[model samples]
Target chain A: MKNIVKIEQLELASAVVELGKKVGAGLAAIGLTGAGAGVGIVFAAFILAVGMNPNLRGELFKLAMLGFALSEAVGLLALMMSFLILYS
Target chain B: MKSLFEQFEIDLYCIIITRFFDVSITTITVYLGLLMVIVIGMYKVSLYKATLIGNNNWQHIGEMIYEFVVDLILEQVGKPGILFFPFIMSLFLFVLTLNVMGLIPLSFTVTGQLLVTFTLAITIMIGITIWGFRIHGIKFLNIFVPSGIEPWLLPLLVFIEIMSYVLRPISLAVRLFANMLAGHLLIHIIGVAAIYLMQFYFIGILPWICVIAFMFLELGIAFLQAYVFVLLTLIYIANIINLH
Candidate 1:
């Protein structure tokens, strides 16, 4: 009975490692929520700027894309961090 | 269940030249196919002159891609950046082609591997660092130091700047690698789910639909990530050259 009970008990170190991965990845993913909202704000402001002056579309678009890439990079960094925690 | 990473497995061919040099047949075949396409396409394009008259579809695409790369270079690096046109254009095409090629069923994505993307990133980083030093000489070290900074904050800011600068290749490589890896894994997972769900009648259609939707999304991402990679490269190069 004691042997079966010991086998049923979870290994503490492995459990902690598993929990840490989930927590780390979850914390890292919090950045994506911010990123998503940030991206939405970027385009929203972009729309407002373009609406104010249609002629600025090309210039604004270039900046918008650059901004988008930079913002996406941050999100990707978070994703990479989480993957590192999970995999490494 | 099969491992999620099984898609990334590389099997060697029977014809091994040496113990240290086992060739991955899938990677070689994919790259060779890409080279053949580029060579044939370039040859076809070279057959026609840049006439303002009616252009064929292939020539039109070729010119458009060329113009786009030129515009990107100019936008970031201005007139001086035109020197990198060939290198940037070829890099963009090669990475983009490999990414799109990965979309095809039963094909390997070279960029999906860190070894491939990391090497590209490290090589470009080294090349750009050399170019920066060549242009600015000892002043290249000034890249770590921001201009018009307060004396007290300078040390911390410089340290952060140096750390971020050093992390460029890693971030660049990881961005491409993780994006491709996640996209491919998602598609495969959804695909396998759909296959398993086929045991049910009406419910199987849902995952199948998701698989199709994600495939299309992945296709767009393949192009977008390649563009982002090239754009970031141009931005990095411009930062070094302009020193601002």
Candidate 2:
């Protein structure tokens, strides 16, 4: 079992709120792990497509960029959510 | 320990107008100083002829930037995007200046703030939407309504499209804001660690090396984030106008 530090002098309510903020912030950021995988997959596909057909590089790149932006938006949303959980 | 966010804390200098509008003088001063420098730099670069015939030293850099922006617009949005060359160039240069200035030691990163970047994104988005509407009229609604949708799936598809469209500005603003904030925070944290570890004889070197490497990475990111921001903006404009 992990050792848990307890402050005898401090009240329980405030300590709980403090702990909640940290844990909540982290929980919100869990979505980013999936987002990272999504982005990597998108770029990996992009590289494969470009390698196969040099002539399709320009068109493939635009699609890849669009995919990247959409994927990144998910990560940013998660980040903003975590910030909100921490502050509010 | 000063908290990691302590670096982002803004100290109010002398208020410019205290009664109705409480303006922070330091923020204004920094913005105006950067603006003046960018304006002068643009003027100097544009003054000389961009020709390989005569002395082509000073104007070469300007020509290169101009050509790059032009080519990027043409490549992304086709010939129609060339109409937005001036706006795109100015926007890229302005963001680039703010981003590079933030790298200066002891300088505030205004671009890193959500307020600044969100305002820019929202205003541009509003303008682009209005422009699209003006050009395409009610037909612009077609952007949300994909052709040949199943009767039952219409609502679901339209809802998803509208939601994604609404999230565009938020995505654009957050991307740059988070990147810069992370870079600056990393640099500050490493610097602080280096200072604290300096008490040890040999351990300080590792943190110092990290600090230097991170600074170089941050410097590259400063330029790259600006480019990404502009490129995305161009893409949005093309999508809006072309509706493809």
Alpha carbon deviation, residue B243, candidate 1 (Å): 1.6
Q: Write the per-residue lDDT of candidate 2 for residues B8-89, one digit (tens) a residue.
A: 6666666677778856667746675777787677657556454335457667667778898998898889988888899999
Query: What's the residue-level lDDT of A4 in candidate 1?
Result: 59
| Model 1 bad stretches (over 4 Å) | A1-31, A81-88, B14-36, B39-54, B203-206
lDDT of 1: 0.83
The segments of candidate 2 whose C-alpha lies over 4 angstroms from its true place after superposition are A1-10, A46-73, B18-24, B42-57
> What are the lDDT figures for the candidates, one per model?
0.83, 0.82
Which candidate leads the pack in DockQ? Answer: 1
The fraction of reference A/B contacts recovered in model 2 reads 0.18
CA lDDT of B48 in candidate 1?
A: 62
lDDT of 1 by residue, B1-244 (tens): 8877777776555454677885546655567577668756874664463453456676777778889999989888999999999899889888888898889887888888888899999999999999999999999998898999899999999999989998999989988888888789879888888898899896847887788899999897888888889999999999998787
